[model samples]
Target chain A: MAARKPIIGVMGPGRTEVHTEPVDKHVELALELGKQIAAHGWLLLTGGRNIGVMDAACRGAKSAGGTTIGILPGPDAMDISDAVDIPILTGLGSARDNINALSASVLVAVGMGPGTAAEVALALKARKPVVLLATNPEAEKFFSGLAPGLLHVAGDVEGAVTHVKGLLAAQQGGAAGGAEQQQQ
Target chain B: MAARKPIIGVMGPGRTEVHTEPVDKHVELALELGKQIAAHGWLLLTGGRNIGVMDAACRGAKSAGGTTIGILPGPDAMDISDAVDIPILTGLGSARDNINALSASVLVAVGMGPGTAAEVALALKARKPVVLLATNPEAEKFFSGLAPGLLHVAGDVEGAVTHVKGLLAAQQGGAAGGAEQQQQ
Candidate 1:
């Protein structure tokens, strides 16, 4: 394995606690995405909390032996999930640069809201690849008539992994050829 | 004012220190989203940094009289933009839950990386309206062929905002008088 893995961004909902009602499906989906990131030798980056999908994805990534990075907002916050490999406490001051936590090659968006969507655009501007899983009606409709080859829509974790693997293979091939040409 | 302003999430590249590099377009985009959020009475959420898109978004939101929130991720992190009203310092030791920074009704995605995508998925699971700007080949393929009306795909920030506004109007109208009448 390489010394570093790809950083995979997972976008979703915050303040999920307000929902009051539990959405069990999110946990499963989050875990699925986490597992995909881990299996593909990618790092998982998120908001660094223990509740809702954040906890689930962290657990999933850990179970798959992937390194998970947590970017916290302050020093006095509550405990994060047990899966975190790096706990970066930026204090209450650096709350806006969480996107910098993971310099990723690709980003996979799972269940998301406005906050999540903002991150999607952030990744795009950074020239990172982003994948969407289990999207909502609004997202689906908004993206209608878009080219499929560019977006990479996956409904499940397995598909997400496969899609990423394909992308990685292409990247590796390009790198290998360039290295060989340089040596020659 | 409407019961709720469509929340906009801003994510993008951030530098630890002010650099001599030319300003990026993301700065203007983030600020625009923030202004629209405030003008529409929607909340603005960000990573709470003083530079980059985070700072720009705060400026726009504040200028437009919007509600701005910032969530810092680390112990040594700097303070949020002056425009931020709610500064949440989540000292959780993970980067996976930054999405928790805001509970948005509508998500407008901006420039970011993998961490940003993670937030997008969380929002999807939460079933919030999503508007994605800057569709590339990867993103286009990642979100292709999904059910209509789930994702709102836009080519730029302006398009994204327009899409979200459409969603907000529909949602508000539905909430006003629907199968189940409720207030946003």
Candidate 2:
């Protein structure tokens, strides 16, 4: 059987005024991050909306031949973008953010907003690692005081991916050590 | 054969240090709001955690013999407070905020934080009436410039309840007028 790919969750704004421009830097960054995550032989998960950062990320992942999943807030497929390979129509609404937090081994926050902030908080509460790609000043300030081990702030997509890979390696090492201890 | 009762969603802090006091004013206020909502023959809904405003509101509603539904973030009933008569384990995590927003005709925001702010935004996006209790200065500032028709800022529990009742009446009136027009 093929090894199960690691799932990396992406959290960001669903709507933003920056989207009015022909090119949004945040979206571009998120797209590059998604591509990097996919290129690393991992699955990408997002809020699954057709607009904003989520859409850009999914699009990037698909462009790199990577699998992507969208955990939608509503039951209808109307809001989901074509970039998603699998659409989990939760019908649970924004509360589905919990699933997004819990389903991934690590979460990448591309931009800060109320929704994205909530996702980051939930990931922290769940004891999952969060990589903040700080594009927004408010989001950066929000996590400035957080304890260092679980949360890592990166200036760009490459820096964020490096952190994610390190965390994943550490997680595997811990799990293997635990297994050996159990055997002994 | 009876009419369906309106569901009023109460959004607030799930975890608070303010809970340590002999009597948390915020909790007390939430409790009173719950009682008022129940006394008005409405059903009350909350996030269903054992701490903070969600607990207080559920307790208040239960005290007044009001039916209370808790939309929990996880599948387990372990975190659900006894104040809730019905607990829905969505396991959707923070994403469940969308459910909390859409399940109610109107939502009362008791406090402001990332989670509560997300709820307020979802309610606004869904075009649902949102009553801000103005307990959190940041939350108040966030909604200060919102259009005045569906969003209302209330100074106290009584004021919040009054606004909710007025919105309910307006909604019913609008529905009735539409029905009358259809009959014509």
Candidate 3:
């Protein structure tokens, strides 16, 4: 079988949250994380808007010469960030968050807002590995009671990238086991 | 120009909410609303899942000999209701909710769960007219502060349909003005 390229989905605040100094810091964190993911030869997926953490991550991935896919909320390509290598216009609006969650083999949440929180919930529901980088109190509170193995809180880009790699390894291991079982 | 057929998006709870007596009432309401929408020559759109209010609405529309569209969350057609004439497999997951909201010229919200509430918010954000039938306190509270002209609270299927027709007329009037301006 051909080696599958991992797709990591990054979810965070959009332009509605405004670009304050604190918000800009979160965007920077997302950029570093995007760069690390691309360096590992993984594709990055985001909300595909030209604002907030999504744009930052897409820019970082592009700078690292990595392919990035933006799953857009509307059919119009105008809302897509220039850094995105591919734009998937779903026209699904906020519900598109589920696409962001399910499309990724693993998800990284940079900051929490209503939209981001919804994506995190969907990712958790799907039992996908979620790495949180500089999450807000609401996100911390939402995942507080969940089982620890599925959720990881990373304080830095390196830690987030490491967690993502470990999760990817575990996912590949499980897939291999399933394939073997089917063959048997 | 050909007269456009209005598409009405219906938002409600999913199967996870269970089909109990109370829940069934909501489904019945959705069914009646769907029938009324179809009878008015308008198309009905729902989440496309077979288990909850989505199924009921689709069934009602089909029974009324109306065309129905299901904006599915997942890529597979298996989850789509049999009564749906058209199944749009977005593979976008919950993000398909935005498609539902955006595709419809008007929206009918039967019950509000997190998913349904998100759709309502999206519809409102897009400036689409939304009709609430038997809305919960949360939904009622959410719309309480919005401009009265854009939101309608209907008690029955007839009332909902009436509100939809009125809104559609208002929309057409606005569109006609734009068309006239373009011609000039």
DockQ of each candidate's interface versus the true one? 0.08, 0.22, 0.14
lDDT of 2 at A21: 74
Per-residue lDDT, model 2, residue B132, is: 89
lDDT per residue for candidate 2 within B14-60, as digits (tens), equals 77632587876778889999999999999999999988899999889
Docking class of 2: incorrect
lDDT of candidate 3 over B1-184, digit per residue (tens): 9987888898787754335656577888888887887788998989888867788888888889999989888888777788888988988666666677789999888865556755765676566788989875444544544334577888888898888889899888888776764464
Question: Which lDDT tens digits does candidate 1 get at residues A1-184?
Answer: 6455667766565445412456566667888889878887788887666666667788889999888887665575576666777876666423333354235566667775554554554454344566778876555444332323346678888888888788777666767777765464
Question: What overall lDDT goes with each candidate model?
Answer: 0.63, 0.82, 0.79
Q: Give model 3's docking category.
A: incorrect
Where does model 1 sit among the CAPRI classes? incorrect
Candidate 3: stretches off by over 4 Å: A1-5, A13-26, A35-43, A47-50, A61-100, A109-173, A176-184, B1-5, B13-25, B35-41, B47-50, B61-99, B109-170, B176-184
Off by over 4 Å in 1: A1-184, B1-6, B15-20, B75-79, B93-102, B144-148, B178-184
Better of 2 and 3 by DockQ: 2
Clashes of each: 115, 14, 5
Query: Predictions ranked by lDDT, top down?
Result: 2, 3, 1
